[model samples]
Target chain A: MRIVVQEAPFDFAAEAQGFSRGLSGMGAVVTFSGLVRDDDGRLAAMEIEHYPGMTEKAIRAIAEEAQARWSLGDLLVIHRHGLLAPGETIMMVATAARHRAEAFEAAEFLMDYLKSRAPFWKKELTADGAEWVAAKDEDEAALDRW
Target chain B: MDVLYFAWVRERIGLPKERVETSAATVRELVDELRAREARYEAAFADLSALRVAVDQDLADFDAPLAGVRELAFFPPMTGG
Candidate 1:
């Protein structure tokens, strides 16, 4: 398992390939990437803030839970912080397992937990001003399924 | 103890973190003391439901004890993914 909290943008394709390569007995791999969305085309950039000491700890706990609940070969989580333009990658999660079901389920589980549990906050910047993005009720509700 | 703020809480309070000396026994009591300090703190902590708290870097409720906690953080619900 690997967890990365960084401000520098990551090369998704390279990271994905690196995560899946040279794995023995792992028959399936699942990957998910989140991107900044400019829904109204008014978004100038997104400013991400996170608790330096707590962010890594929280994400590691979530990843460890995923590992315990699923039969897997490996998992990877990479989250970026700081300013980012629309369409840029925000984060990515990858899970490798002996079968697709476990891989996919673990990936989704990681996402759901990371959405509401992590300490990162996002602020949307536009021409008019900036507004903090609110957490959705649906996002919290999504945790109940697991 | 160290008190930290994030997102709008930091903006409203006008600082990211500060050293706090207090005899508060719980998170709620600490918040009350902070609210009494200044109007900016009052405004930042106006709605308890709109904020979340962490004790020593772990999420906790306002009613949680702060007996041995060295760090406390207040922020809005996380929007991470």
Candidate 2:
């Protein structure tokens, strides 16, 4: 398992390709990427702030939990912080397992945990002003399943 | 101990982090001390339910004891992915 918390943009295609390669024992690989949404077309940018030391620790814990719960060959988590423009990739998760079910389940589990467990905060900047994105009740409730 | 704030909490507190010397035994007591200092702290901590605390970088409750804690952080609900 690998966890990366960085500010620089990552090449999703290259990362995915690298993750898929050299996994001789794995039969399935699943990857998910989150992008900065520009729903209203008025967005100027998105700013992400995160606690330096705690972010990596929290993500590692979540990734380890996913590994423990699933029979996985490998997994990767990459989350970016700081200023990002619309259409930029914010984060990505990739999971490899012996079967498709395990790969998909682990990927979803990682996404769900990372959504709430990590210490990153997002602020949306628009033409009017910048606003901190509120945490949705639905996102918290999504953890009830596990 | 070092006290840190993030997101709206940092904005409300008007600073990112600071060194705090306190005798409080728990997170609640430390919060009380901060609240007694100024209106900004009072306003920042007005609603405990709206805030989250971390002891030494691990999420903790307000009632968690501060024994041996070198760092404490306050922030809103995390919206990360």
What local distance difference test score does each model get? 0.97, 0.95
Question: Which candidate number maximizes DockQ?
Answer: 2
Q: What is the overall TM-score of model 2 with all chains considered together?
A: 0.98
Number of clashing pairs per prediction, in order: 0, 0
* Error at A29, model 1, angstroms: 0.4
In candidate 2, which residue ranges exceed 4 Å CA deviation?
A: none
Per-residue lDDT of candidate 2, residues A59-125 (tens digit): 9999999989998999999999999999999999999999999999989888888988899999999
CAPRI quality of model 1: high
Can you tell me the CAPRI class of model 2? high
Q: Extract clashing residue pairs from model 1.
A: none
lDDT of each residue in A1-146, candidate 1, tens digit only: 99999999999999999999989999999999999999999999999999998999999999999999999899999999999999999999999999999999999999999999999999999999999999999999999999
Q: What is the TM-score of chain A in candidate 1?
A: 0.99
Q: Give the per-residue lDDT digits (tens) of candidate 2, residues B1-81.
A: 999999999999999999999999999999999999999999899999989999999999999999999999999999998
